[model samples]
Target: MATIQEIKIDLEEKSMRTLLSAGTNKDCKIVAEGDSWFSYPVVKDIVDHLRQMGYAIKRHSKPGDTLENMVYGTDFGIATQVQRANNYGPISLKETLRSVKNLKPKFVLFSAGGNDVVGSELAQYLNHKRSGLPLFRENFFRDSVNGHIKSAITAFLEQVWQVDSGIHVIMHGYDYAIPSGLQYELAGIRFAGPWVLPAFARKAITTRTEQNRIIRQLVDIFNELLISLSNTYPNFHHIDLRGRFPNEAQWHNEIHLRKEGFEQVAKLFHQKMVEILNYNPVA
Candidate 1:
């Protein structure tokens, strides 16, 4: 399994508590790493506030993995490094493992898969095109990434479990996106309307159920596979943020959380964190 080094994991058997590694620079402690889907402003708000509250955050971004160590809080001092993930390595599951291995945090929240999903989608599209499937890429959808995604997730979790049984893992699931034909207005134009729609605006409508079907099915499959693996492990959880949004349109482009979906996500995750940590939600 791949690893992300240089993080510290502070274990208290408590849920939703403020991060314990405030001023420590232990590798792989209190780690949070993900892909571009996390780049959305709505998705970023939670991490931002966590950092403001003196919780250190590490982000994986493009143009390579750049670690930013910032200091906050006078009494409860903590410095965090936001690691940019992309420019250096291929941003595959390996880099994630490397980052986690470096931090070695007790608790980790993995915000990943949008890239993998998009990549799989594109691959399906190209393959379908070459095969002359007659279905437009716009009309087709990639339900999920291949077993590589599954393998990556499983390998990492198993590795963590073996490395430390006390380490808690919250395998964050996919978020809602913009829905097709939802009549959303973006960039001074309503997608439900024609003509005035900007070239950059997405006009494809895959319908709410279809899009949800694609994502939910994949989430269910992957989460189930992950959970099945977790049955033999400790402190592993599958965090679902589905339908937690006010609208189904949040999943428009695949995995980016909608502008209106963060609060619900944070609440659900925060509550789940509180629940599991408080009671060992996992068997």
Candidate 2:
């Protein structure tokens, strides 16, 4: 059995080659889009592993994309806007379908909606709970959030089908983020985070354990929404990644996992893809 470090190094090496040779091979193109989770090394490692097993990966993810819009770029602070200038010109649902008009893809991996609720929106949700508004009014905001996410997902799926009715989509609900407030130190760039932890503090939910529970509940709501969508779409599959990293050490901060943690998550995604598609690509 390969050690975690060995697995990581191999994935990293393959990722560089696969990325460099992107769009060159057309035999086994797979499109993956969504948020930072898919844009970062987590899903990239999975793509690398898949490519090593004979697959060509085409990615459409951005670092801070939500269900409806792609964020401009890497805005390290609390992200408030979902719509922004796509400086990177990411392949969105529209672009994905357009790309596939010429050539069909086997699978689409999507991870989104986490950003829509995490920052100021989260604070608003909590504030609504404290507001003296009628029960129906409070429910309106919560329901609207879920409704928007579900509708966006439906639209994306419909577009995929319009391009190729046979395309399979693989999506995952995010794991519960630890309220660590740890600073990010990847390569040379640095950013401070654990955005939820600070947000909870600002909202007067200062107790760490209580904060964890509240955040977990919030995450559950989103996951349930995803599950419902999965049931509705025959080709859309949802992987529950809520507890993949249960400990603090596995996390880099609030929303992201460390490399080992990311590897585990990616392996789950890879395993699910192989199981569903029965993909046995020639190496």
**TM-score of each prediction:** 0.54, 0.75
- Residues 1-283, model 2: lDDT tens digits: 9764466466556644654564644435677777767555332344444545565566666665666564223324333586444344323656666656654667777777777766435666664324454212236445855677677777777778888898888888888877777645555566434567667666666667766776777778778887887888888888898876798877766787765665676677667767776764432
What ranges in model 1 sit over 4 Å off?
1-29, 41-43, 52-54, 61-104, 118-146, 161-163, 179-212, 246-254, 279-283
lDDT of 2: 0.65
Worst 10 residues of 1 by lDDT: 64-73
Where does model 2 exceed 4 Å of error?
1-27, 41-54, 70-91, 128-141, 187-189
Q: Per-residue error at 164 for model 1, in Å?
A: 3.7
CA lDDT of each prediction against the hidden true structure: 0.43, 0.65
Please give the lDDT score for candidate 1.
0.43
Clashes of 2: 0
Q: For this target, which candidate reaches the highest TM-score against the unseen true structure?
A: 2
Expressed as tens digits, the lDDT of each residue in 1-283 for candidate 1 is 3211111122112212432445453322355655433333323334433333343445443311111101010122233465433333233444445655655665666655544443223234322223444322423332333345555565556655666666677756654333332332445564322211111123232345444444454444545555564575567777765556545454433334453454455455555655755642222
